[model samples]
Target chain A: MADVNRGSRPLSPHLQVYRLQIPMTTSILARITGNGLIVGSLVFVWWLVAAAAGPDYYAFVNGIVTSWLGLLVLAGSLWALWYHSLAGLRHLLWDSGHGLELATAERLGLAVVIGSVAATVVTLALLAWA
Target chain B: MEHLTDRKRAEGRGSARSGTLHHIAMMISAGALVILVPLFLIVVVPVIGAAHAEVAAHFARPFPALVAALTIVVAMHHFRGGVEMMIQDYWQGMTRKLAILAMILLSYGTAAAGLYAIARLAL
Candidate 1:
């Protein structure tokens, strides 16, 4: 049987204690954005190795990239880049002692997500036309 | 009061150095991205059209190669610092902390080897 009545223990000063603030929110968002960057880097590494191998390998990767699924991954990478870039800017501002207020932080966090999507769309459109 | 003053000074120095290193690493990472993204678009994208020789030649350019090298180095440094912080926060025992440190060292070492290979090829 499960111990349903187990008492809660004292916890460390984690995210739960205070109201959401910009610095904490930005830090959380940056971590999530880092996952995207990591995945994108792995894809890039695969592309690099494929390019270095030979035409056959290159063609294989090229085919995948030109496909719908590949395009989706490429789009994701672009979104990751923009998201991480905006998050980076947020960190830069925090380091400079600005944007510490709750309203500003929340506004910037929303902007980062929306702006990343916008940037990704623009990049994909340009790539498609070019 | 005297002891408290000494402790405050030590904390200040420690934080100041940490902040400076982080700022420098972030700036380098940002600058490298500026160079790398355009290089990817300009030189590398077209290489997808050309033969392997042409691609090799393009990478062999000193500027592009240098940019690649810098990007790799700065990226590894940034990753190492972030991993170290994560370890400090989550790892409890000394054994776990040491293990985390060892992992970080190995990661940086491997990255260094890979960057060296890329640089040598480019040069």
Candidate 2:
């Protein structure tokens, strides 16, 4: 007979069993930023294609990219670039087997976050000057 | 004990595969960018000019022209690899996953066609 009062069936235990590590955390963040960059790159592609197409298409894209909305997209792209770059460096270090220590991993993670913001600001400054 | 050992082996295999794929993708992207960015800056930018220039002028220099070609190729390859991984993560159903894969292929194809057209242009 079926148990009418059964609440749930046994499921695989995953989150409770695996402990988080630095490489895992960095990989997760990289995946997120990588996704962001994918979308942002598509936007860039559109702008480039439009520019290449002709003046009218170029103006249309230029109008959008120069607007507040465009600025937001640009900012997001910058963030993704910086995050991905730092994450790439971290992966490079890991490839060389240097940052496996927990403390070093944590420091690098923090640097990735901080450096991304700093780089973005510098890029924005350059864009403004241009 | 046997089950535990099997699970450990499976985990190890999975991690190694994932790490290898990641490394390969990163290497390709890094290598391509090394060739592409400079070309865009030196050749493509000057020819395109700040305000106005004929499309032909844009491809005036061979080095910049080659860079533009590499940029399209490398950027598309890098983008497709990243997007494929993302689709694998977020799409659970087989049909949806297949759809995403098709979309990625279509995108790469379009970019390739566009690049070919640009290359054929005398500018």
Candidate 3:
């Protein structure tokens, strides 16, 4: 018979009990940003579909996405994209048997955080220039 | 079951029959995105708030349309994989199956829509 009392088993202390660390925080951010990009992806799809539908529809979506609220989402997504990309590179490095030490992992985590913000700012600057 | 040794039974059953195929696919797609994403942003970002005609004309060009299409397809595929893992982590039983199914549909559906739209604009 299956263990019916499994639900009552003592559970280990979990996420809330531990103080946060850079690698842990960065790993969590990676999952968050990866999933969050879906929103931005859907919005961009809507923009394309609207454009395909008609000029008027395109104008409507274009207007909304260009609006301040939409811009905010875009900016967030831009940052998320950069962060996720850098996080992914870190994973790839780990996969190759590199950067597994705790100190190095923490440093990579910091780099992911700071680098993403810097990349977002530069991209925004370039967009403005263009 | 006792006839087989542990190593023999587990040899081909590491997390599924496909083994590391999913991981390999994700790595390949991630590498692809590293290229496709920057090219895509360069193509699409500048025309953010442009008028309809200008925006349409810009994307209607072959290079921009192609970049957008590639990014849409690759990104959605990657999203599908990532979301599947998330659902598996947090959901269970029928809910997990259904959610994964729904997301698979959504991911491919969006990819198809984007491709169709890009095709229309380009052609």
Candidate 4:
């Protein structure tokens, strides 16, 4: 006799392992921003190549970076850059045997987020208001 | 319960050969970046929306040009190490090896490109 129905197979899904928290979310965001910077750096290569290529090409590449969508992306990438760098600093602190306490760890996580925004804003001000 | 002996553990020192090297290299680059990145932005942001000639001249200066060069080089190294870890986390098998190779090429290629452009501008 052929078995028509198999008994319910066990399904293990991993989504519920940890309740959402700032440190966890920020850690994931750090990974995201770290990779985001890689992609953004590729564009830096293009811009540099275009700069060396000539004036016409420079203008062409410049147009893209200065455009509205490009501006948004540039701003976001700037934020990511600051965020990623700050997160790396936090890691370095952890490596040096600092910020191991739970309260300090959470504070450092929050500082990364706040500091990134501040850095981005200051940069934009320097760029625009200078 | 059986546990590994201290002699056995001590014998396996640096079996991977790259033990702590990756961590140390990455941390070194990160430390350099902590300074270079801010200096780069300070030297760079003012010239962003300016004309091409203006931007070129700004980088032609020794200070800005040197800062930019160091930042690009160190940043690419950091970027490679970070991205490699992230990629390894998501992919495995042949794809992982291939992706890591591609990332290395991309990082160095980009670094070279930026350096060349800065050289062209400065010289």
Candidate 5:
């Protein structure tokens, strides 16, 4: 009924066979965080719809979005936004015939992680101050 | 090593017409987002935790409204092109069709709703 034995075939190199590197991991994470960003965009939609609906509706929606859970989603979203944007920049560099070197690629990958974290912190800190 | 003529190798590599197109579209959108996102963050961050009237007033201003609406719409376009490549890489046949359609609709729906809200706020 099912080809349960397909796993035994000599397939391409699988994950278990070797070590993973930063660039490799970041590349995969880019797609994941992209999806996360999409979900986060819905928060904005909720805000807009509530605002149009009226002040009471806006407050209700805004209250939920500002709660601890909402903050977490916002934080995740901020990081996703930063990370994806930077990674996309890296891809653009590649498209333009730069950052093709292995060392530079790995460095770019690390920058995505660090840059996103920094941007999120700065944005949140500014929000706190404002 | 396998023997190959230049023409044979070129033909074997397969059609890349759509691949280049996708790459260019994605890059253009990425270029726009690189500017729009930061501008949007700058605009929105100042108004965080603000009162409803204040928030509405902030968005009603042309600069924030325009930056945000463009960012949302362009970002969706970029997302669609990029995510479709990922989906195609792992999916095929019916699954690919369904997944691509679902993603496109989500992106398009988001873009439309977002623009409508911005239009209401701005106008």
Candidate 6:
């Protein structure tokens, strides 16, 4: 006879039991970056709204955003945006029935991380020059 | 033992039968973002530390204003869906419902505010 309380059974091993790998790290990064982008989005929106509000308010917000701490946050957000975008592209590839093999998947994961960093650097450099 | 086909067993069960819709929504937004995001970056990045007037004048251009508006709408919609899935995975009961509600509101509110601001700049 099946136990009526089978619903209470313990679930399988979770994060604590697993060894981290490139794919796992990249997947976790996808979520982190995706959620993390809200900060940058909020700040950018505030800047826009403030600009629309008045020059004083816009100056205040702009001053803060141009500060060192704010620049750090912006840099982090830039990297996160790039990482999430690339990871999303990787997912689209998987959805199309490719890159499922272990080696290819891992390689793609590595590419996402490295590519995002490179993209961020190039963006920042271009922004500086412009 | 109760008998049912595998397909029959799979039917009518899963996140209120909207899993595919959610996935398609994410994919569509992702596709849109692939285009809009880079365009937005190109539009906004140059004026990051520019003076108030310059920043406003920059966004006032048709290209920049349009790109920013579209990116805000689509990205927020995508964010809402992604956060809903995250909440579903980690939360339950009323907390999950409330969290989802909060995220949805946040996403739309951000989008509305952003669009309004852009509209002001463009005008």
lDDT tens digits, residue span B1-123, model 1: 333544454574444357677657766676566566555544444443345566557667877556555655565566566555566556767866796788577556746664654554475
What ranking of all candidate models by DockQ puts the best one first?
Answer: 6, 3, 4, 5, 2, 1
**Candidates 2 and 6, the one with greater TM-score:** 6
What is the lDDT of every predicted structure here?
0.63, 0.65, 0.89, 0.84, 0.82, 0.91
What tens-digit string does per-residue lDDT give for candidate 4 at A1-130?
A: 1332335866677648778787788899988998888767767667766776778999998899788977887788889999998998898989999998989999999999999999899888877877
Clashing pairs for predicted structure model 2, backbone only: B56-B123
Please tell me which model should have the higher lDDT, number 1 or number 2. Answer: 2
Tell me which of candidates 4 and 5 scores higher on DockQ: 4
For candidate 4, the lDDT comes to 0.84
Clashing pairs in 5: none
Compute DockQ for each candidate against the true complex: 0.11, 0.19, 0.43, 0.29, 0.28, 0.45
Q: By DockQ, who's the top model here?
A: 6
Task: Assess candidate 2 and give its lDDT.
Answer: 0.65
Please give, for residues B69-118, the per-residue lDDT of candidate 3 as tens digits: 99999999999998898998899889999999999999999999999988
Candidate 5 accuracy as TM-score: 0.87
DockQ of 2: 0.19
Off by over 4 Å in 1: A1-9, A12-26, A61-68, B1-54, B94-123
Q: What is the DockQ of candidate 1?
A: 0.11
- Which ranges in model 3 have alpha carbons more than 4 Å from their true place? A1-4, B1-14
How far does residue A48 in candidate 6 sit from its true spot (Å)? 0.5
TM-score of each: 0.67, 0.71, 0.91, 0.86, 0.87, 0.92
Enumerate the chain B TM-scores of all models: 0.58, 0.64, 0.85, 0.84, 0.83, 0.87
**Per-residue CA lDDT of candidate 6, range B1-123, in tens?**
145555666676555878999999999999999999898888876777788888889888889889888999999999999999999999988999999999999999999999999999889
Please write out the lDDT profile of model 2 over residues B1-123, one tens digit for every residue: 333554454564454357577658767696666556545534553332233245545544466556776766776677667667677666767866786778678568756754654564435
Which predicted model would earn the best TM-score?
6
* Cα displacement (Å) at residue B75, model 3: 0.4
lDDT of 2 by residue, A22-126 (tens): 557767878788666656656655655665677776677767866788768867876876787678777767777898788888889888888889977876676
In candidate 6 chain B, where is summed lDDT lowest over 10 consecutive residues? B1-10
